[model samples]
Target: MFDDTFCLNVRFLLNTQFKMIELPDNIAALQSYKPGKAVEDIFEGKNFDRTAILSSNENNLGTSPKAVAAIQEAATNSYLYPDPSGMKLRQKLAAKHNTTIDKIIIGNGSDGILSNIFKAFFRPGDELVSSAGSFVAVNVMTKLNNIPYKQAPLTKEYAFDLEAILDLVGPRTKAVYLCNPNNPTGAMISNRALKAFIEKIPEHILIIVDEAYAEFAASLSSEFPDATQIELPNVITLRTFSKAFGLAGVRLGYGVGSQFIVDTLMKVKLTFNPSIIAQAAGGAALDDAAFMQETIEMNKKGLAYYYKNFSQMQLNYVPSFGNFVMLDMSTEERAMYVFNQLLNRGVFVRPLAFFQLPHCLRITVGLPEECQLLVEKMAEVMTLEKN
Candidate 1:
């Protein structure tokens, strides 16, 4: 018995030693981003021929024809290194935003720009302020840097409670992150409220406004906030091509701010961070104004359909200004159960327990057909639970 136990102990120690690779304290301790399951991972051996992924808020219209053609034309040049400055793309985007190219710095995605923003301004023990129920990336970034961030509670309506946010700010607060037309709940902070909040905040604190879903918010103009023209010294707005521009696979995004802030971030930004193809695709995507218009119109229709269905089913949902909506499940567990069942039916949506919103799920607006399939599958799943 002693011999057998000693042999087992030796094998266990050998395995542990092999697997215990050393890593940076922060990198080793970090809780990584939990990505949504890919279609292949969910249906590897199953007979599913078609899967509808509404989990990630991506453009369903596919890539713009002009962008696709540009990519094909540029394919031959892939062997050579791309322009480090990405000047042409920057010029075009600057023109689109009514700002000089110097005011924009492109990155892998809005998330990349966000990380740069954090790194440029944040350090250990610095405090960051954000809404309690927000995108997971905010928490991930804060924890990774060992920065202190307080989650200001949203109002009963799930909108940004500007007063609560201001109340939490202190001397250590280096930055505040906000998802204008916030994720999961889709509640937005209005321009008037933002202006008021800005007035109250200390000038030293930087405000990072992530507008990944801004095109959709613009479509809901009357209900959504006017984010285009809030000139503040410390405010930075991040936008991405992954959503309305249909360039998720290409992963391109940029941030718009005063030249001072832009230039400061550029100092720390990875040289040639945005890939050649991504920059080219982003520039081409912006040029396709007609495609963008169609996408806006379709998203409006899909959101309307979602609201009508929610009302018909007597389900409680947070009114959305973005391309997604949050439905209140009886419990977070129930929401998760429904999420799994939706997966079984080849429909994917997001669960928001990470944001402390356990009773809700974030469903992205898809094409009409995809939305219909999702609603039908949801109905079936809920009915089965009732039984």
Candidate 2:
């Protein structure tokens, strides 16, 4: 015969003690990664019937019909567990890249693959060097893992400063994370520059080239290097089906590296990381070459439209190789003002304050009509600012 009131009091005391427990120093100090605002949340109470979501750099043309069909087909077999090894997807990806299947490792997303790498290789106090104002995920991951990191400032043109990064590397440096066609700024390092930089890096250091936006950049410029094609054992390329493939919602990405590195990551990767549906969608997306081409073409038109309008307005912006452009508002206050104003008018763009580029806003290249709407809204917002 247990006393109910006494049990309740004891449980309450235990919960209070648990709440007071201290978190690890690194975990307590970590700042969360903030994604772009959702369209539904922004337009929840507003009377606007339509919204142009240019915040997240997603393909606005929607997922490929082939991928949708594959997903629908895969839904029937949800009862069984996913292929834990992801052999089929890995084989297809390896074939496409002209590499052995052992070189490919599938993940929930590129983020998941990165986590596996960090866990497998990095130790507390090991140095991880990266470009400041580049992809913020590397920084977040390093901090969460308690790995010491150093960031070199970007060049005047907002490109990765290879020289500064090289200088920062030392005996303790374990990894170097480089985001090609970098996020927020959308600047890229030339093939020659990248090769020269990689040559200077010490053999002990791992070179992580995150090419999530590689398809978009490659379409725009022949100078962009395909890291997987390079014969360097130390270099690992991270890619995703999220961007040009129009399969972001599927959460499928992969890493291409040497057999040794891939084997190491496999040990750390969770069993069945990517679901069955995600694998099917990714395979179908890769097969739909026509849809991928169409998405790239649409992005090109959107970029041209944005460039023409931004130049006409005499606004400063980075010449982007990726599917997004960063517009410099010249001041943090003005950027914030414009962001809120655009939201009020049913438009969403990513303000770069969290990424440490407070004076800039990153807008994704959506469909043609969406780009036109964005330009129109910007004109109205600027006019309102002046008056």
Candidate 3:
């Protein structure tokens, strides 16, 4: 409708308006979470056939056979939108948890569901409490939602400091986030401690128990607490098929809570998430008991190997209940040196500095060959460091 001069003027005005729109203060202050590097990323400069990505705590055994099959079948129906409610997957999850479907909440992943929880439930002046070095995602989520996050230091054993956390729970606190078999450290609170902590929390405070690695922890430790089994109306138990189920690529996770809480979360959740293939994969993965057992057995063996190798090398390491272990490198500088050396050797691991653990690094338990490679590379690096 206008000539070239008018068009140029309009373009300049639009650009100026767009530039003036700034991110919210909270989001502006956020530091992006650093994820594990891909095999390609680590080996980009150098060409090497051997590579092990023990970074993201993914299952090294590949995708679940049952889930792979389901994914393939679902791909044929990709033209249709995913079920808004994710009914079939919810039904399966509810059955597994021995709860009704209304109590179940599914999302793109446990992290996705966690973000939705913040949006739906968290409000200004609402403080969230947790352990200091627990999960970095919680740190990100709190800032993302502008929720006031308070934390107590971890216990000497690296488990959640229940007493300290409870002491920090003030009248302004609305929720507590606990990551059992916590990420990076893989430390878990015993069943008794978990129960005691829950009882101490005020009834109005929502306790979120994120058991992402619960299946592995339960398999490895008799003392592991399954929070979903507690059946508390105020407690929300979140689990994911991403880890032990070997469905990380599919990104399926769920939460078990009261029906009212589920409804509230549903209102904020994306209408169509965890697409058709993901939902189908999740449903099938639940039935793959043999695969789960294999994952656990492999994880057990891999962890033992890492512990033994680390011990022989005189490196301090945390005994893990999950599929990964944390190695204390004595200082942030040492940790970064180890990380860079491993990266050069085509072995990618995660640095825990951002997890408030600057002196440690996390390594996922890979397959037998991969584990051996990691040990060999670590030995070489440490030997060189000493020299």
What TM-score does model 1 achieve against the real structure? 0.91
Off by over 4 Å in 1: 1-25, 32-37, 48-50, 226-228
> 1-387 in candidate 2: lDDT tens per residue?
559988778889887543467899999897655786555487777798668899889999999999999999999998989999999999999999999999999999898899889999987678899888988777788888988889999998898999999999998899999999899799998899989999999777899999999999999999998888876778899999898988888899999998888999999899977999999999999899999999999988889899999998877889998999999899999999999999888899999977889999999999887898889899999899989
- The C-alpha RMSD in Å for every predicted model, in order, reads 4.5, 2.4, 2.6
Residue 82 displacement (Å), model 1: 2.5
lDDT of each: 0.83, 0.90, 0.90
Worst 10 residues of 1 by lDDT: 222-231
Q: Residues 1-387, candidate 3, lDDT per residue (tens digit)?
A: 799988779989887543467899999898775687645476776786788989888888988889899999999999999999999999988889898999999999899999998998877899999998877989998998999999999877777888888999998998999999899789988899999888888788899999999999999999998888777778888898889988887888999998878999999998999799999999999999989999999999999999999999999998888999999899999999999999888898999988999989999999999999999999999999999
Error of 1 at 66 (Å): 1.1
What TM-score does candidate 2 get on C-alpha atoms? 0.95
Pairs of residues at least 3 apart in sequence or in different chains that clash in candidate 3: none
TM-score for predicted model 3 compared with the true structure: 0.94
Per-candidate total of colliding backbone pairs: 0, 0, 0
Which candidate, 1 or 3, would have the higher TM-score against the true structure? 3
TM-score of each: 0.91, 0.95, 0.94
Residues 1-387 of candidate 1 have per-residue lDDT tens digits of: 669889779889887543577887877788666898564486567676666788778888889998898888778778877777778988987787887888878888989888888888886678999888888888888777778889889888887787888888888899888888888788888777777777888878998888888988988876455443566778888888999999999889988887888888888878877877887788789889999998998889988898898887777889888888889887988889989998898888888888788888888898889889888888898689879
